[model samples]
Target chain A: MLSENSDKIQLFKYLEGIFTELEQQKIALDKSAIVAFTDIKGNITYVNDKFCEISQYSREELLGQNHRIINSGYHEPKFFRNLWKTIARGNIWSDDIRNRAKDGSYYWVATTIVPYLDASGKPYQYVSIRFDITKQKNQELELVRRSKQLEDFCFIVSHNLRAPLSNLLLLTSMIQESDDSEEQKELIGRLVKPVHLLNETFNELVESLQIRQDTDIEKVNLSFKDCLENAMEALNVAVLYPDIEVHHDFNEVPDLKYPKKYLDSIFQNLLSNAIKYQSPKRKLQIRIKSYLREGSTWLEFADNGLGINMKVQGHKLFGLRKTFHDNPDAKGFGLFITKSQIEAVGGMIYAESTQGRGTTFFIKFNAK
Target chain B: MPNDPMKTIDTLYLIDDDDTYQFIVQRTLNSLNLVNSIKLFSNGKAAIDFLEATLHDIEQIPDVILLDLTMPIMDGWQFLEQYLRFRPRIGKKVVIFVVSSSIDPRDMQRAKSISEVTDYIIKPLTKSKLISMLHESLES
Candidate 1:
């Protein structure tokens, strides 16, 4: 009997050692700024090292004390009452709160509070975990301020630049259509070139602004053939080179309900790029093919052009103000804006290319 | 002004501050021979004054008013509002056409909704479009 009692004592000692190890782990986790609060009628009690640190009191000092002692007075009575009303009904309250530290300085915390119930199923205490988010909040505010400044700058640039551009367009139309002598017409044409360049620059600026503006995505049934025809119409002047050939095969594509302008611009930019960067050795051939794969519409723009060197330009290919080709007309904005416009309306763009062979752009539209 | 009632009925009244636009449009109208006479106004106020003063005296008001949506003092939208108030006073034969360079669809939709606006045309107005407008006016 004596031997059995001794064995039972040893087993109890081993269980106590395991319980203490778990308690230590729990305490270590709580040290990451978790606190528990109880009402005036004390129960299992409040817990947290952060609560002790902020209040300049240990867990022993905070256990029996009401939440009023640590209250920073930053929040009014109504704020606390509303918080209680929400939590007492077994709902969680999560928000950013400013609390006064023991040193009389204030700190911001993102807080989440959860309530605990006793044996009678009545509210006993609340466990609150808080993370320091003051630095992030400050950075966000600064970013907002800087963004507003940038938008203001863009507004000024747009107004100042567009007015002159409108006048230049009017002037060019007047000069071009005017019945002038050959000599006079040549002089006017010479003058029109710079104005055209200015107009193109302004157009690029406006395109960038439009990209920055909020994108409103609306889905409507649109025919692929109609969209292709519209793009061709818009690019009639640019695609006048007799050598270039564009072929479209839409056997698999059905009417899709997607953002129309985004798709239109995507096709326009890609087609224009194909025509703009044609290889000197070969005639430009652009083949557009569409197919449905796994409930998504996949369209490919395959071009026979001076293809991109993915080994070098891949890093900056879709980045703003990045130009890779030696083509004088390359603004480096086409693919960047095109990619953003596509993604803004919930589509993805990818490219496959070799240095001298050709390039193909694959775009996948989300299934309706 | 031309004396023939038929010719005068199809005349254009252009209101804009830009001298170049005025000159170009007048030249285009003459080349096309679409109208008898082209009345010009530098601003909305001048146009309004001309209409109000000659409301009863003039034998025929213009067939079409080519209005610029954006102007120095009074814009096309404001002109429409004020013109509508005086429209009943003027003859019902006149039609207001909003001519603007803005490609914004909202502006086009707004113009379409207005009772007084006959049509919204994007600039720079070509010779064929002007001829088409004359044809439309004759049919209407």
Candidate 2:
């Protein structure tokens, strides 16, 4: 109320101006932070407009709810236990927490939960001040994934490169230990084996490197049957196994918009592998089919040949220079490249097999 | 005790996919008179098959098993994992030495971590190095 005296009216206006300034500062602080207040039992008490905006919860909906309402379940139980312990002890707990919003999307928040104490020095309320850090957290996760891939790449390169080099060293050493001139000549002649392998390995590495770059994702609509026919013609499976009965059914999904090179390579590898590992005692049977499954088109190549023992070699099935049989003709580069090609086009490759029984390979292609 | 250490290891097993390694290493063993018998396998699968079948027979398992890391069918790591399961059933206290061309520290760490793996040797296992290894294991 303003007094009739001019001096009293001026003083009242001055006090009102100071209060308005303080209220403006409070609004600015609330806007900058996602603020919430919870009771000692962690029940939600008060939440600023910013908090409601970020969590997509209204004041009435969140008033009685606990912090668990927005819990993303991404963290371990021990994390929340430690956080509660610290805050319950009237201490500030600061951590990066991932919480879920009403729309089911997750966001990261760098938060500080400060406990407010009563006259008796016991925590009565906790004020959580949070700043969105989802962008930073995503960057950190991407960095970690890339570093892990780099490490795996280093491992593959080291293991594959060293195997051939070892042969070179051992081959020369063996020749050095020999005495007979004729035997020496034979041993020296055998040197071509390791040398040829080294050359093959480097060539495979170069090809795989090109695939890993994954810049050639140009696609054209192509028929599955035609690609298979082309690959079979190149491989000449009929000459290799005349009695090898082959079947194809691509009615459900006859064609794909995929990279021509990758499709041909995949077809060629699967066909040759089936023919190469054909059972010695029985006639080989091969069946190829394509169908739509789980929102993706899948190509299945099933062969009643010398099936791989998936139990033993499943993990390294797609690894570079990895073989699952004693076939001298097994170069182990085909599957590696096949997998790389499949994955490059947002697809995947896997196999199931039983030794001396049969092996089936599945290639998932994008439905588009 | 046998006066000659070479005779101590009456039989040895070499498991590797590389034919060149098998050839030269076999010759090196023969020239050095390292053992009276040497059984060879091209992959871990064959060696593991033998081990599983002969778990009850003490004479079947060789004194020294030189394992290669990279092989067809079953890799050395897969073999080691399977071996750990059947190790208690086997009668012999066989010593397994991992021989790999991989100079990667991860392989070295993996080899050292396995209780069944006695040692990890890099490729180019010379005759002299083999002889010295024979002496070390025999002495222990």
Candidate 3:
């Protein structure tokens, strides 16, 4: 009886040791990972400090709430349904989930949910262990975007380069065959335009590539009025567009930190496009405005000119060599270059237009 | 195919965005004596619109179409999709050949996959290539 009592005591001590080890492991996991417990119906029951920290929700707010409270809506319904189906069958489900925080900021987490089963092998509760993977996920997305950009770059280069180059080849071949002096002279004259076009295309492409690579170009704080005047002076817009009327309101956001050349180029391109595409029925009118929204400075240019069909041409508006209108001077380079410049420094540019009415271009500058 | 002694296509359509290409191709056709009459369209949309308008007129319909792949309004692929829809309505056999500066194998493969396309020709279409295209159109 004494030995049996001793055996019971020994078993109890071993059980206590195992319990202590398990508690320590739980503590370590809680410190490193976002941990949450939910009932079979996916209602949050418990959450660790890390979970509250990452999700930007208090423990009080999280408990009794559904996991959908933090749902980013990036994933489809089928994704969640599949996950729930897996865990419902007392199986583990794992995936990278993008969750929205209390402040509406997005974060990605590598999540693993294990279902705790009852005696009948049915899930009673679920324990989700998630590690913050936002940084890596963003990097992966950026890499994919960059690769796609490179692919487009290659396609444009090959396609645009070939057109002129092939024309040069054909023109030279014809010139070689022509014995008549007058015909040879005309063919050579014809050769001049293609050569000029090739040079322009090559130069434009190089300029765009340079802008993309020169992300760290020097920026200076400059007045909006001054920048506009500088672009006008550079383009000789006052002389070139004598009848063009310009209006401005920079009271709300007067100055911006940007690369001088890029800003000037963007202004020049937009101004020239507006002027060149003005409707024959109406005089050219331009309105420039600056404001602040969501910690970013915005510059808006609204033009009363010949607007294009946004539905059909919007997607290709900023694409290289994509012209919607039959304007003889449209090389389709202005918007593409402007977009590249803006995007180089984490800025964005978009347009809204109604056909035959007008166009408004909005530029959102990076807060940094 | 052997040189068929300067054979001519009855009516040929040249659809391309590049005016330089249009000029050079027209000149080449004249020099080679390959086409009786040429109709030019700047893009696929214009060409397709012309075809839709002239469906019943056998005289207006092109005997051969030299289609460029990349254009502003509608590309060659989109043109093919639209063409396939109404192609059966046209009574005459109209052969399409993709004439593109794109050397991308995917473009060639896609053009070849279209049963309506007779062939895919890379740009700076040589004298021999133009002659062979003429023979193909004549036979069709």
Candidate 4:
């Protein structure tokens, strides 16, 4: 009877030691990771302090909320469908997820979700362990963007720079074959155009080079109205386009936090294009509007001018060193630079045009 | 009429955007007395319109066309496509000489494959090159 009692006591102590070790491991995991538990239906059942801290939510706010409350809209529905399917099959699902915080900041997480199964081999609950990867993800995205910029630069070198050089060659030939002094003087007068064309092209290239070399941009709060006014003043469009009608509505979104230079460039390019392509049949009419929609700020610039035939020239609208119009001054440089500036700041710009009717451009800015 | 030494080209069409090139070619043609009349168009569209309007009258069409490749409205390649469509209706055996400052091999190859294009000449055409081109056009 004494030996039997001793054996029972030894078994109890062994069980107690295992329980203590398991409890310590759970505490350590809670401290180190952003951890959460959800029922099979994806409703949040429990969350560790680290989860609440990173998500910028109180424990009470996070507990009963669905896992989708933190959805960033960065990933498509197919991604979640695949993830859920994997976890529901009692398999561990792992991926990088972009999540939105309560304060509207974006974060990335390297996540692993393990599903706990019931007796029937069905998942009863899911336990997710996530490590913050926001910094690393931004770095990787920037690197990819920079390489794409380099590829664009190489294309510009091969394509856009050649036109001016062609002009130089033609002018050189003209200078060579001229016999009379008067004809030579006239040819000399024409040489200025090709020289100016080469200078403009080089200036544009140098500007792009600066932007590419130093990716750092200083962002500040910018007023749309002020920026547009400044651009117009600099271009002297008020005097040059006395008959042009310009209208704007900036009540919905008056200001944005962006690089001042980029904003100025965007405004200048679109305005110049509107004026330069104005129809000889009528007075120019341009409308600029800004508003908030679908959690993003949008700017619409519309012009009733000689619009493009999108069906035929849509693909090359913003192509480098391309011109669809017959105007000799149309260097095909404006839209290309505008696109570069917008995309560099994580914004998007697109256009809708009907030939001989009108053109409208939509710019969607990123939500901070 | 092939290689008839007595019949000289009377009319020429210069389709190019560069004014300097237009002036140079006009003066050169006058100096050499190679052609009697020269017409200049800033782009291919105007030339195409002329050709289409004058399709029934063979005399209105130019004897030779010196076409620049990179024009603003319609490029040289596009011009060729449009021209080939109306070739049978036009009823004119016009020789086209592609003139370009670009020495790109792809451009040269592309010009060679077009049956309507008689020759591809690098820009700053010499009098000798012009004579050779005219001779080739006559022979063909």
Question: TM-score for all predictions?
Answer: 0.41, 0.81, 0.83, 0.64
Q: After superposition, how far is residue B70 of candidate 2 from its true place, in Å?
A: 4.0
Error of 1 at A79 (Å): 14
In candidate 4, stretches whose alpha carbon ends up further than 4 angstroms from where it belongs are A1-160, A173-179, A279-282, A294-296, A309-312, A323-328, B1-8, B101-110, B121-132
Model 1 C-alpha lDDT per residue in residues B1-140, reported as the tens digit of each score: 22333552455689866555576578667876767768898778888888787778545467788998766456678878888888778765777788775555667899999977889987667767776777667566
Best by lDDT: 3
Count of steric clashes across candidates, in order: 0, 0, 0, 0
Summarize candidate 1's per-residue lDDT along A6-116 as a digit string, tens digits.
999999999999999999987876867656666623332766766676656777866776666556788778887878787787678888777766677766778888777
**lDDT of model 4, residue A312:** 95
Q: Write the per-residue lDDT of candidate 2 for residues A1-368, one digit (tens) a residue.
A: 34458878788899999999999987887989999999998899999998899899899999989889999999999999999999999899999999999999999999999999999989999999999999999999999998886677666666666766776777776677778889889888878876777777677778877887866678899999999889978987668667888899999999989889889989988888788878998898899999998778999999998887787878767775533223544656778889988888888889999999989999887645
Off by over 4 Å in 3: A64-66, A84-91, A117-123, A213-260, A289-299, A308-316, A319-329, A342-348, A364-368, B2-7, B44-53, B69-88, B102-115, B119-122
B1-140 in candidate 2: lDDT tens per residue? 33563456766889998877788789878876757778899888898898788777777777888999878668899988988888878776677889887777888998999988889998778777787776666665
Sort by lDDT, best first: 3, 2, 4, 1
Each predicted complex: what DockQ? 0.02, 0.48, 0.44, 0.14
TM-score of A-chain in each prediction?
Answer: 0.51, 0.77, 0.82, 0.59
Q: What is the TM-score of chain B alone in each candidate?
A: 0.88, 0.91, 0.92, 0.90
Worst lDDT window (10 residues) for model 4 chain A? Answer: A321-330
Q: Which is the better candidate, 1 or 2, if ranked by lDDT? A: 2
Task: Kindly indicate the candidate among 1 and 4 with the higher DockQ.
Answer: 4
Considering only N, C-alpha and C atoms within 3 Å, which residue pairs clash in candidate 4? none
Off by over 4 Å in 1: A1-368, B1-13, B35-37, B49-63, B80-123, B128-140
lDDT of 3 at A244: 86
lDDT string for model 3 (A6-95, tens) is 999999999999999999999999999999999988899999999999889999999999989999999999999999999998889999
